[model samples]
Target: MKKTKILFYDMKDYDIEFFTKYGKNYNFEMKFLKVKLSEETAYLSRGFDVVSAFTNDDINKNTIDILAKNNIKLLAMRCAGFNNVSLKDIKNRFQVVRVPAYSPYSIAEYTVAMILAVNRKVHKAYIRTREGNFSINGLMGFDLYNKTVGIIGAGKIAQILIKILKGFGTNIIAYDPYPNYEIAKELGFEFVDLDTIYEKSDIISLNCPLTKDTKYMINRTSINKMKDGVILVNTGRGMLIDSVDLVEGLKDKKIGAAALDVYEEEEEYFFEDKSSQVIQDDILGRLLSFHNVLITSHQAFFTKEAVEAITVTTLENIKDFIENKPLKNIVPQDNN
Candidate 1:
């Protein structure tokens, strides 16, 4: 039997290396494409049995139509997020599978890092110390012990993070529509309502998926309900927090400090080197002007373990599709 041929869009160097290595053991041939997948670029996958896409790729109805027209049978999402894909369009036309769980510790640890970095002014201190300004004059950090941390999602990553935070003796209050009571009991955290999460937490971390209810969920109204000088960190999807409202929140000191690994409207800017060019996005530009904010190029999921798991899980998804096996990572049309 011939091996299945897969066309991989948005191929990073690491992706090519990992996929090529792992795919060899699985009897699959992967053709790497660096271009972002779009309706026009769907032609590139012609004759291929499967198309593997990334988080940032455009996988709308038009792109799905073109992909179907070009004889693509399956879409293997190499990342956990499938928000970009038009699941309705691909419902019966083609199968869709994704890497639902990579190394949760990668993001869980990164979320903790962001919290510590922003709270202790580590980023600023690194810059100042590098310039021989060792003065700790403006560098002030608070204690984590006995502090209240409200997590919006109580999923795998959130569970891991709560365990880590518990080591610091901080109170963990969570809000999830579908609460895993067993995990809450096992992890020793409270499952509170959204309003209680907003008013009570000293530090608010977003670890939820981007859904209709969560889109721009952290807007002006929500921020207003938060404690004065509350710290905020987002390692989740960008649109979870409205950038415009976030800027306003930062301006008014409603949010004492903010650290973001993802941003709204980040598709055009993130994952690219635009060091020489002016930041044309006004909201992003305003965000950069804030002294209390730290932004990272969405790298929370870039750990070695995460990458390995992502590659293996994605290849497994592809294998299951080709072999007509039950897919473990088949994402539902809507996460409603």
Candidate 2:
């Protein structure tokens, strides 16, 4: 009756605190590492039974091969996204499971917060009032009522967001590869195409997963199709919108404002504090220079409830693997 050993990569303060508290309930020995799971760090899993990764960890083919060589049996992603992993490479090497729906409400609520904060210029207003300069100059904001909101990807999070927006009296249009007309009817929204989403939506939110076809989906061509002064919000994967193209859109006033929770190249900077170091990413630097842009570290799904659920579900996934139970959260290959 030996306890299973789990090696967690990219460990944060909250992760350590919560996982340790939860680990007590299960007969599991856990080791937390600050370094991300990459090809270079995969060897560290040689003596461990399982490897746990976060959203930003590099789980490419090389890393997968190393993990396989190290005798790691399971690769558990603590987050919902598997875009960082090389799924095809992991097919025969080891099994992979993820917390697919830890807390859809967490992300959906955060998305609304971003939309409201940017549209109302609350960030600017806070700074201005703090300086004792509350003249209300250039602090105008429009009402969310009667606005046309187009949502990309009609997943659970997107559906929740649509329900929240419906309360605001805004018209909602959605675009999804697998459109559910029943859900659309139930939610009081219409499923439209990407072109219609671009042309009709006064505000657009990206809630889709990253895929081969979706990489840099919001490029110059897509931006050109969007309505002028459209408010863009991305709580989904960062690579969904090209930062370079977004900067250009902001410059040309094609995009009125943008709120981003993720970045394409965020592994080196997102979770860690770089306040003392200068930003080396030119696009990120340029993006920060804009007054209308709102950028946050990837924390949309970092709620107390969400983290707790993630911890419980992840442990259950491991427990199932050890007991030879069918994994409910197993990631399928080539959904890209």
Candidate 3:
């Protein structure tokens, strides 16, 4: 009997470490490729039974056609979000499975860290203290107690973040298309309309997934409704907020501070060392120039636990496919 062959794209050291350690138990032949899955790189899947992609891989129509032609049965995504993949293209071509919720706590905790760092200027303080300047001259920050926090999505991560915020005695308001009333009641948070979330909320956090309706949700029109000097935090998809509009908001003093773990055009820069090169993207350069803006290279969900969970879940998804087990995490044709 031939063993299942899996081609892992966008391979990194950590991914290799965890997957290789656990993959031995599954008795599968796994190959790692540093190149991302794209139209050009999709041809390499010819002899593989499964193509394992990461968050940044290009999984559009062109790539899917190649993978399908190569007889790839499964597209296993190691990350939670599949926004990079075109679901319609893969509808009848091949089955897709993803690690949907691998350590929500990692994301939730990182979000809290970004929020606190930006609001209290903790990042700046560390730098100032290191420079031997202990003056609290420009370190004024508002208290989190009694602050109104608006969450865009009420998923597991958002709920966990809300619980943490509640410890600071915050008024939590969330907006989700499919709101869980029971969870809202239990979490002591209210589900409100987007308009209400904008009108109120001293601190606005975008935890929503990127969809047709959610892309650029924080444009100039919505930014106009937010409270002046509002702190914005986004650990979700980068496309959820309009980068250009955010710059304008910062310039006009509408947004006080911003903490971003993802950017709309992060594929070229994130997960790689670009310290030696000049940032070519103008908008990203502008964002970095802001004193109140804090940008991280999409490492919110990069905890040790999350990595192990992702590896185990991805391998299990493949195992299920090979054994003809039901794929519970399969990406449906019309999934939104």
Candidate 4:
């Protein structure tokens, strides 16, 4: 009885700690690689039963072809969003599984943190106080009580955020293709159209997944509709907002403040220390130059609880694939 072997790319220290702990009980042989999965790294998958990767990994058609050629049977994604993967190109070569829900509270709470930090300038205050400057001038902030907050995508995490915002006495408006009318009625939040959400929200938060319908959802036309001096936050996928358009909105004073935990081209910079190098992305550099803009690395899902849940679920995906169990989280490559 040979144990299943898995080659995990983009392996970080936390991944090592948690996976090693849970995976030992599964009797699986794990080969962890620090480099992110890509066409160039596909050859490394040879002889492995499956390839496990993170959000930044490029699991495109070419890489899939190579992995299929190397006898890899499954693509196990540790993160929820699989937009980086070319699912259409999968073409039934192998099954894809992901950890769809992992400590939604971590992300929901982080979203609230960004909202408070951006609106109240709490992060700036901490810095100013540390520098011995306690002046309140230029530190004027808005109150969240009775503020209009618009949320996109009412998923598990968004639901948690709604509950949190309700405590603040906010007027919550959400937009999701399949609106949960029951939840909306119960939570006392209203479901509205995209135009309404954009036109009315004082603080807008993007909590949606990235899809063909949602990529660059916040662009020039949509930004023009938003209230002037609106505070924006995105803990969702980065490609959901157009970087250039967002920068322009900030420059033209259409958006008052932005707190972003994700950026469109974050793969090159996030999750790694780049203190020795100057940022090469002009858009990212411009974003960092603003005092009103707060940018955090893609760390919303980086809580201790989230990491353990992700590791456990990802390993379970691997085990289920190897054992030929029904994959509830399998991402279907084709609906046709």
Candidate 5:
């Protein structure tokens, strides 16, 4: 029997190791492609049974068409979020599978870290301490205890965040269209409307996936409803919150501070380093100038545990496709 050929695009060291180890057990031959998946690079998967992609790869309609033309049947994503892929266009072209739940704790913990760093000015304090400036004049911070925290989308990551915040004695209010009643009752969280959350929360965090209805959910109108000097944190989909509206809010003192792990226009340059070159994006450049805002390189899911889980699940997805088995993380076209 001939071994199944698997092509992994934009894979790192751990990704290669995981597939090499697990794929051998199933007699699958693995090939690695370091280039980003695009129309030109889709040919790399030619003659392969399945193609595995990373978070930053472009799996658009053209790329999918190219893969389909080459007889590739499966598209396995190593990340939990599938917003990067064009689901509508590739629904009939190939079977799409993703690692839906990979270390929610990693992202939840990182969100908390961002909140703490912003509220307590820890990032600035660390820099000052290294410069031999031990003055604690502007390092004052308020307590998290008894503060109202509004969590958007009560999913796995949000649930984990709620659990950790519960220990801090914070009042938690959540807004999710599909609320998990069991978790809400257990955690003593109030499932209220979005408007109420905006009006009442001292801090707001976005943990929802990006969809047609959810894109630009947090815009100028919603920001107006929020309390003055409210802290905002986003570790979810970049497009969920409009970057323009956020910048205006920050300038008008409507938002006290913000910490972002994702950006709306991140595709042009997120993982790549363009420090030596000029940043062409004006909004991003302006965002960096604000002292109250902290931006990360979409690294909330960069922990060792998360990386391992993603790799294992990705390989399993490919294995399931080749073996004619049901996929645990298959992204259905219709949510119904």
Candidate 6:
């Protein structure tokens, strides 16, 4: 039997190794492409059975159309989020699959790490110690115990975070349109309204997916409702919070601190080394200048378990598509 021809695009060295090892077990002829999947790069997958993509790749309508034209049937995404892909355009043209729940624990743990680092000012302390300044002034941090924490989304990642925060004895209040009452009851979390969460929570964490309804969900209006000196953490989508509003809030001292693993306009420069070069994005540059803010290079999902799970699940999706079997993680056009 002929081995299945697979073109994996925008994959790193480790990712390529993982796929190469796993694909050999299933007799898949895997071709790794360093270039991203776009209209211009779609021709690279000609005569291939499937095209694998990563989060940063451009899987827009034109790209999907090109892939369909080139006889690429399967679009396999190694990441959970599919907001970058055009669902409407690829509905009938090609089948889509994604690794939806790779490792919620990785993201949850990273979120907590950000929260702790910001509150304790660990980043600043490290810098100060390196500079031979032993002064501990203005490094006061409150205990997590008995503090009110507001979680915007109550999905798998949020649930894991809630369990961890509960270990710290923090008061949990969550705002989700479809609340998980069972989990709330088991974990002693309160399902409150969005405004109540804004007014009451000492720390606010965003763990929701980005959609048309959730775009700029945390804007100037919502920022005004937040408690003064609130700590904000976002390990979710970057567009969930408005950059302009967040800068204004930081300027006005409305937000005491922020720990962001994602940014609204991070696509242009994230996951690459631009440190030696001049910073171009004004909002991002200003965000970096603030002493109270902590930013990471979208590495919340970078973990051994997460990476293995993503690789295994991605390959399994391709195998299922080729065998005409049921796809567990098939991404439909309307998952509303």
Q: Which ten residues in a row are the worst by lDDT in model 4?
A: 327-336
lDDT (Cα, tens digit) per residue for candidate 6, span 1-336? 888899999878889878777777796888898888888899888899899998888888789888998898889998988999988887677889999998999999999999999999999999999999999998888999999999999999999999999999999999998998998999889999999999999999999999888899999999999999999999999999999999999999999999999998987778777979988999999999999999999999999898889999998898898899999999988532
Q: Give the alpha-carbon lDDT of every model.
A: 0.92, 0.94, 0.94, 0.93, 0.88, 0.92
Tally clashing residue pairs in candidate 2: 0
Alpha carbon lDDT of residue 193, candidate 5?
A: 95
Most lDDT-accurate candidate: 3
Q: How many backbone clashes does candidate 3 have?
A: 0
Clashing pairs in 2: none
**TM-score-better candidate, 3 vs 5:** 3
Task: Write down the TM-score for model 5.
Answer: 0.94
Report, for all candidates in order, the number of backbone clashes: 0, 0, 0, 0, 0, 0
Lowest-scoring 10 consecutive residues by lDDT in candidate 2?
327-336
lDDT of 2 by residue, 1-336 (tens): 899999999999999999999999898999999999999999999899999999999999899999999889999999988988988787666889999888999999999999999999999999998999888877787899999999999999999999999999999999999999999999999999999999999999999999888899999999999999999999999999999999999999999999999989988889999999999999999998999999999989989999999999999999999899999999877633
After superposition, which runs of candidate 1 have C-alpha atoms over 4 Å from their true positions? 334-336
Clashing residue pairs in candidate 3, if any? none
How high a TM-score does candidate 2 get? 0.97
> What overall lDDT, based on C-alpha atoms, would model 4 receive against the true structure?
0.93
lDDT of 5 at 245: 93
TM-score of each: 0.96, 0.97, 0.97, 0.97, 0.94, 0.96
